[model samples]
Target: MKSKKEKGIKYFLKKLGPGNHYPKAILYLMLVFSIPATVLNIGSDIAGMGAVSNLLIPAIPSFVFSIVFTTVLTITIIKFSYQQIAGILKWLCLSVLLYIIVPFFIKVNWMDVLKHTFIPTIKFDQDYIEILVALLGTTISPYLFFWQATMEAEDVKHKIKAVVVDKQMLRDVKTDVNTGMFASNLVMFFIILTTGIVLHGNIKDISTVDQAAKALEPVVGKLSYVCFAIGVLGTGFLAIPILAGSLSYIIAETFDWKQGLDKHFGEAKGFYITIVISLAIGLVINLTGINPMKTLVYTSILYGVTAPVMIAVILHVCNNKKVMKGHTNSLLSNILGFITLIVMTVSAVMLIYFSLHH
Candidate 1:
C-alpha cells in the first residue's frame, strides 16, 4: 500500500491530469496578468511593519527585515503539508481580531457608525470614490476566490476517495465560509470606525504602515500600536502564501506539473519555483522607493478593475448545470453574487472617471 505522502502526491497528479482544463487555463492567465497587483499587495503588507518601526525597530531595517522575514516564513510554511498549513492559517486568522477590540477603546458616535454601516451614504468626490473602490477591491479580492476553491479540492484529495460530497458536508462548507466572511468584514468595519473616530481628521494623511500604527497611540495608548503591528504582521504571514501559492497552484495545474504543499522540492520543482519567484518579486517591490501605502491602494484599484470579470466568470461557471452537476448555486447565491458583480463594476467605472477628472 502507498504511504500517506505517496497518496497525497498521486492525488495532486490526478488533479493535473486531463479534466477542468479550461478553468485551469483561465486561472493561469489571470495569475500571470495579476502578478503586479499581487506583488504590490504583498509588498504593502510587508511594508506595514515599517509603519510602527519607530517604537518597534528602526524604520529602514525593519522594512527590509519584514520582506526577508515574510519570504522565509512563506517558504517554510509552503514546505509543510496542506493540513499543517491549514491549521497554521486558522490561528493566523485570529490575529486580525485586534481590530475588533480597537473600537471599544476609542470614543465613537454609535449613531453615526450605525448609519454608515447600514445606510449607503453616497459620496461622489474623488477621494471618497477612490476609497470606495479600494475598499471593495480589498474585500472581494481575486486571490481569495482561487485559494478557497483550491484548498477545498486539496482537502478532498487528501481524503483519497471518490468525489462524492454529502449534504452535511455541503452545509458545513457553507457555514464555514459564511462565518469566516462575517468575521472578516466585521473586523474591517470596526477598523474603519475606530480610525474614523480617532485618526481621520487628526491625521491628514497616512503614508506608511508605521504612521498608521502611530495613530492608535493617542486614542488607546502605546500598546495599541503593538497590537496593530502584530495584527498586520500576522495577516501578512497568512496572506503572502495565499497570494503566491494560488498563482503557483494555477501554473502548476495549467502546465500539468506536480503540485501541492505536501510534495518535496524535487518532486514539485516547478510548483515551488513559481512560489519562490512570486515572493522574490514581492520582496523586490519593497526594496523599491515606492510609497507602500499608495502602492497598496493602487494594487486594490487593479483588483477592483479585474474583479467584475472574475465574478462574472465565477457566476457563469458555478451556475452551469454541466459544471455543477445538479448542485448549482441557489437563488440567494445568484442574487448576492450578481449584486457583488454590479457593485464592483460600478466601483471600477467610477474610479476610472474620478482618476481622469481629478
Candidate 2:
C-alpha cells in the first residue's frame, strides 16, 4: 500500500514536472495547507496573544465560518452595485474599489480593527499623504482603463448587440468607468485593513513574488502560503484579460480599426491579434530570466511620478461641461480627488529622495 502511494506521488510529480513551476507551486500550496491546515492554523491562533488577538476567537470555527459569510457579503455588495450602475458605470465603481486597500483575511478583534481604521492615523510625515495616494493610484491602474475601453469596442463590433453607440452611449461608458473606479478603491481599502491588522508591520519590502506570498502566513496561519497563491491567482485572472485587452484597445483606437471582442475572429482579426501579441510580450517579459518584480517596482515609481499629470487629466475630463455633461463629478469627489493627488505628489518626491539616498 505504501509502495502504491509512493508510485502515485511519483506519477503526479512526473506529470507536473519542474518546468511547470507556477502550477507546481499552486499544487504544493494546496497539499501543504487545505481545510485541515486551516484547522491547524486555528490552534496556532489559539496560542495567540490571548484577548488582544485580531478577532476574538468567539470560537475557532467563527474565524473559518466568517470567511464564507464575508465572501458572500462582499460578492453581494458588488453584485448590487453592478446592477445599480446606470450602465457600464460599474467599471468606475470597480476602479474606486481597486483604490481601496486589500483586506488581509488574518484579522483579529475585527470590530476593534474597524474602529481603529475609522480613527484617523495621525502619522504627520510630509510623505504620508503621498504614500497613501500612491497606494490608491496603484488600484485604478492606467493599463486597466485602456484594457476596458478596448473590450467595450470589441463588444460593439460583434453582432452581440446590433447597435452602434451614439453620444448617449458615450455617457453610459463614462458612468461605467466611474463606477469601476469606485469598486477598485473599495477593494484596496479592505486589503490594507486586513493585512495591516494581521501583519502589523511584521514584514516589509517585498522583493520577490515569493516574499509577497510568504508574508501572508502570520495573518492566515499555515494556509497563509496557499491563501497568498489563491489571491495572486485570482488577481491574475482579472488582470491578464485587462493587460491583453488594453494593448488591443490602444492599437485599434490609434489605427481607427473596427476591432472588438464580440465580433467573430474573422470580423475582428486585428483586435484579437493585438490581444495575442500583448500576452506574448508579457510572457516574454516573464521568461527572459529578468526579475519581473524589479520591473514592477520601477513601473510603480513611474506611476507615482506621473500621477500628477494623470490626476489633472482625470479632473479636467471629469469636470468639463463638454465631456461629463450633467454627470460631472460631485464637489465632494473633486475635493477628495485633489487631496489624494496632492498626496501622490508628496509620495513621488519621497520616493525619488529615498531612491537617491539608497
Candidate 3:
C-alpha cells in the first residue's frame, strides 16, 4: 500500500484508477464554477471596503480604485509562506468578533434569536430557496475541501523530517477542523443576528458597500463603524490570496504543474501565473459594473450546486479502506458527512425545482 504522506483530494481520486474519470470530471466542473465565483467573492470584499471608505472618508475616490489597490496589495502578499498567511489571518479573523459585539449594543430578543436559530423557519419560495442555497454554498464551499486537503499535504510536506501519522495526528486534525467550523459558524450567526436586528426593516437589501457598513453603526457610533470597515478591509486582504491560491492549486493539481507557496516564483511560474491570471480576471470583473453583492449571492449558489457531488466523492474516499490505509472515518464523521450531503443535495434540488417552476 502507498504511504499516505502526500495525500490530497487528487491523490484519493487517483486511487480509483486511471480509467475511472468521474472524480476528475467532477473536479473540472468545480474549477469551472469556482474560478468565476471566487473572483466575484473577492470583488465583493473589495467593494465592501470601498463602501466603508466612502462612508468614512469622502476623498478616497470610488470602489474601482479600491479594487485596483487591493489587487496590487494582494499580489504582494500571496508571495509569503502559508505560515505567514495563517499568522495574518489569525488577526483578521478576530474582526469577526466585532459583529458579535454589535448585537449587544442594540436591543435584541435573545429568546427570539435562539428560537429562530434552533427551530428555524423554512421557506419554499424561489427567492428564499435561492438564498438558502447561497448560504449553504458560502458556508460549505466545494473549493474549501480541495484547499483543506492541499493544505494538509503541504503541512506534511513542510516538516523538516518524516513524522508519524498516528491516532494523535488524527485527533489533532479533527480538533483543528472542528474549531475552525465553530468559529466560522459563530461569525455567521452574529452577522445574521446583527443584520436582522438593525437593518432588517431599514435596509431591504445590502446591495452596496454603504449598506454593509451601516450594520455596525449602532455598536458604538462612528468608532464602531471605522473599526468594522477596517475589519472588512483586513478580511478582504486575507481572503483574496487564499481564494486565488485555492484556484491555482485546483488547476495545478489537475495538470500536474509545479505548485506550492513555499516555491519561489521562478521555480513555479505556471502556478504563480495561474494565481495572477485569476486575480487579474477578478480585477477585470469589478470593472464590468456587476453588482458586487449580487455577484456574491450568485457565487454562493454556484458553489451550493456543485458541492453535493464533491461531498459524495469525499464520503466515498473517506470510507475506502484501500485509500485510507485502514484509517477509515469514524461513525460520527460519516454520520455528519451524510447529513451535510443530504442537506446540500436537497437544497440544490429545491433551488432547481423552484427556478424551473417559478
Candidate 4:
C-alpha cells in the first residue's frame, strides 16, 4: 500500500511544466515582497550565531563579475541570433572549466591535489558522486525548460498581439536559440558558483532545495540572501507559471486545441485549466511538507538519469532545418555540444551502474 507521501511526490513530479507565458506580475510581486522579510530573518539567524568568524566570509567579486558578464551575454543573445549564442557558449564552457579546475593552485599542494583530482580514487568518489549527480541533473530541469519554452511562447504572443494591432511582422516568436542558450548559461553559472563554493571548500552534501537557498548566504554573504531569495522565490513564481504552462502547451498541442497566449483566458479554458492543475500540484509539493532538500535531491537524480535522451532531442531540434532554419549549430558548437552530451551520457551510465551494483 502506497503511503500518502508517496502519492504526493508522484503528483508533484507528474505535472510541473509551463506552457504559454510565465505570469510576470506574480514574479515581480514575489521579489518585491520577499526580500525585506528574508533579510530581516537572516539577520536574526546571524545575530544568534555566537561568533564573528562566520561573518568573516566574503563573496568573491570575480564571481559577481562573471555573473554580470553572463547577463551581458544574455542581452547579446536576445539582440543577435543563434550563431552569436554558440560563440559565446563555447567561451562560457571554457570559463566553466576555469571556474571548476583553476582555484586549487592558490593554496593546496598542486601536485597532490592533482593526484587526487585526476586519479579519482574509489573512496573519495563516493562522497563526490552525490553532488555530481545533483549538479548534472540540471540538464533536464523542468523549471528552466518551462521558463524557456513559455518565454519563447511569450515572445511569439507579444509579436502576435503587436501584429493584430499594427498588422505587420513586428516581431517573430520562432524559438530563438540564442535566447535559450543565454538562459541556459546563466543557470549553469549560478549552479557552478553554488557547487564550486561548497564542493571545492566544504565538500558537503546538499540534499535538498531549502539547503540550496541557505547556501547562498555563506557564498554571497549578508542581506544578499534577500536578493537570493527574491531571485529564487520570485523566479519560482515565474517558474511555477511556466511549470503549469508547459503542461498546458504539451496537452493542447497533443489534442490540437486552440491553444496560444494570444487567446484570452476565457477562450483558452483548457490551457488555463491545465496551468491551474499544474500549479496546484506544485503547491501541494510544499504543503505536503516533505523535506524540500530531499525532494530536490531525488528530483535531481531523476533528471540526471533522464538527461541523455533530452540532450539527443535538443541536438535533433537544433539540427533539423525545418525547426531551426538558419540558426543550425555550427561545426564547433556541434562538437562541443556533442562533448557535453557524451559527458552527461557517461555520467548517467555511471550513476545507473553504481545504483544497480549497490
Candidate 5:
C-alpha cells in the first residue's frame, strides 16, 4: 500500500467517502490541541532545566520565543534528513534509561508493584479519573497514529525501487512496532514508580520543575537534578519535531496539498507553512502565562476525550475489506481494538460526568 507521497489517516478516511468531512474535522481538532500541548511541554522542559541548574533562564516569553525561533530555523534552513533526525532521537531515547535506573537506586516495594501490575486499583473520583484519562491519552496519543502512518508511507515512497509487501516485511513491521511500544511503556512505568515512591509524601503536587526533578535526588544526589533536566530536554527536542511534522502531514493530506519533509521549502510551501504556523501558535500559547505543567495535563485529557472516536474510525477502516484488502485485522487485533474502544469510551464518559457533577 505504497504511494508516490505520504497519505495519512485522512487519506484512508477519504476512501470511506469522498464527501466525508467530519472525520477530517475531528482530526484537525485533535491537532489544534496537540500543537500547543507539545509547545508547552518543550517550554516546560527548558524552564525546568534552567531552574534545576540555577541558571537564570530568560523570562518565559523570551525563552519560548527562542525555542520557536531555533526550531523553525533548524527545520526550515538546515534541512536535516529523516535519517539524521532518527539518529539524534536514538541518543535522546537513552535519556529514558535514567528513569529505569532510578527505581534500582531507591527502595521499592516489589510485591506491591507486581500486585498492582496485574490488578490495578480502581477509582471513580474526578481527580483520579482525570489523571487516568490523561495517562491513557498521553500513552496512546492520536498524533502518534498519524505520525507512524505518514512516516511509513514516506519511507516507501522514497525508496529507489518499488518495495515488495511480503511476509518478512509484515513481520519486520510488527516487531518494530512491538519493540517500540514495549520500551515506551517500560520507561513510563519506571518513571511512575520512582515518583510515586520517592516524592509521594514529600511533594503533594508537582506544580513546578524543582518538584519534578526531586524524584531523582534520592539516588543521584545533585546530579539527579541534572540527569532529570537532561532527560526532559532530550525527549522534548525529539518529540517537538515529530509533533509538528504530524500536524503538517494531516493538513497537507486533508487538503491535497503538496507535502513531504524531503521537499524543499519552495517545493512544498503549504506543507512547510503549516508546520511553521503550528509552531507559531504553540509559541503564542506559551506567552499567555498558563502553567505549562497544567497545560500538559489538560492536553492529555483532551487527547483522551477524542481518542475513542478516532479509535472507532480506525477499527472501521481496518476491518473494511475494501480498505485493507487481504491485510484486514485478525481476530486478536479486533478483540484488542474493541476492548480499547470500550475502555476509553467508558473512561471519557465518566470523566465528563464527574467533571460536571463533582
Candidate 6:
C-alpha cells in the first residue's frame, strides 16, 4: 500500500502531464513568438553567409541557398529518425570552435575585456535595457527547459515504468543539462570576445548576423568573413530544429497527442503539423521585410517576460519533497535558484519601466 505522500505525488505528477505539460503551455506561447525570431535568425545566417560565399565563389544567390536550405532541413527532419538527428547535432558542435579560434587570430585589449567582463558597466538607456533583457532571454530560454525535460522523459520511457526518479537518475539529469548549458555559454562568450576585439566600435551597428561576422573581416581578412558566415549557418541549423521541435513537443503534450521525433509523420501528424506551422510562420516573418536581428532581440524580451514565472514554478517543484523526494534541492541550489529569480525579476521590471517611460 502506498503512503499518503506517495499517493499525493502521483496525483500531482498526473496533473502535470507529460513533462510538466501545464507549465509548458506558457512556454509554448513564448515559442510561438520565438518561432518567427528563429526564422529570422535562420534567414539572416543564410543571407549573411551566402553573400560572403558569393563574393568569393560567385556560384549562387542567397535566395537559392535559403530555399535549398529550408527544403533540405524539412526533408531531413521528416525523413530521419531521432537518433540520426542526434548524430547531426553532435557534428554541429564543431561550428562553435570557429568562434573560439577567431579570438586567437585577432588582437585584443585584454585589460579592457577583463574589466568589462568582471567589473561590468551599468547602462540605463532603452536600447541597453532591451539588449540586457534579450541576452537574459536567449541565455536561459524557456524552450530549453521544455526540451531538456521532455528528452529525459523520452530516454526513460523505454525502460522505466515507475513514477519516481532515483537520486542517481536526477544527478545524471543535472549533469547532462548543465553540460549543454555550459557549452552554450562558452560559445556565446567567445563570439562576444571575437566581436569586441575585431568589431566593437569599428561597426556602428550589426543589423544582421552576417554583418556581425563581416565585421571580423578587417581583423583576420576575408577568411574571418567566410568562417563567421559558415559559423552562423551551422549555429542556425542546430538551433532551428530545437526551436521547431520544442514547439511541437509542447503543443503535442499539451493536447495529449502522440509525440516523438522518432515517430513517422503518419504516426504523429499533429506533432509534425505543429512543426510545419511554426516554420511556415517563421518564414512569413522573414519575407515581411522585418529586420531579423531586431526580431531576434525583441523575441528575447518576450522570453524575459515569461521566464521568471516559469522559473518560480520550477523552483517550487525542485524544493518540494513531493516532487523531488529525497532529491529535493540542496541549500546551495535553492540559494542560486533564488538569486536567478531575483536577477531575472529585476531585469524584467527594468525592461517594463524603460519601455513605458520611452
The lDDT for every candidate, in the order shown, is: 0.76, 0.47, 0.75, 0.46, 0.70, 0.71
Assess candidate 6 and give its TM-score to the true structure.
0.85
* Per-model root-mean-square deviation over C-alphas: 3.0, 18.1, 3.8, 15.1, 4.2, 4.8
Over 233-335, each residue of candidate 5 has an lDDT whose tens digit, in order, gives 6666667677778778877877778787767878789988887776666655555555656777887897888778778878887877765668889999999
**How accurate locally is residue 269 in candidate 3, as Cα lDDT from 0 to 100?**
87
* Clashes per model (N, Cα, C within 3 A): 3, 65, 0, 11, 0, 0
Top candidate, metric lDDT: 1
What are the TM-scores, per candidate, against the unseen true structure?
0.90, 0.57, 0.88, 0.54, 0.85, 0.85
Residues 283-324 of candidate 3 have per-residue lDDT tens digits of: 666666667667778889988998898788888878876667
Please give, for residues 1-358, the per-residue lDDT of candidate 4 as tens digits: 8556444433332232211223445333333332232222222222212111122233433223223322342234234333343344344444333333323323445566456555754532433565566667755553344445554544443334322222133223333565656766665654554455445656366654445446555545554344344443323322333334455665665454656554565667786666555443443333333454455555566566555555665676677665444567779879987997887777767776776677
- Candidate achieving higher lDDT, 1 or 5: 1
Model 2 scores worst on lDDT over the 10 consecutive residues at 45-54
**lDDT, residue 158, model 4:** 36
Encode model 1's per-residue lDDT on 106-148: one tens digit a residue: 5678887788788878888888878888889889888787787
Considering every candidate listed, which one attains the maximal TM-score? 1
- Compare candidates 1 and 2 on lDDT and give the better one: 1
Write candidate 2's Cα lDDT for 1-358 as tens digits: 4455445443442333222323334333322222221222222222121111212234553334323322432233223322232234333334323213234343357677668778867564545544554464465444554556444543333312323235665666668777866755567667676556544667756555455545765555666545554444334334444444455555564455655444455666786676555444444343333343444434444455654655665566677765444667889989988997786777667666665665
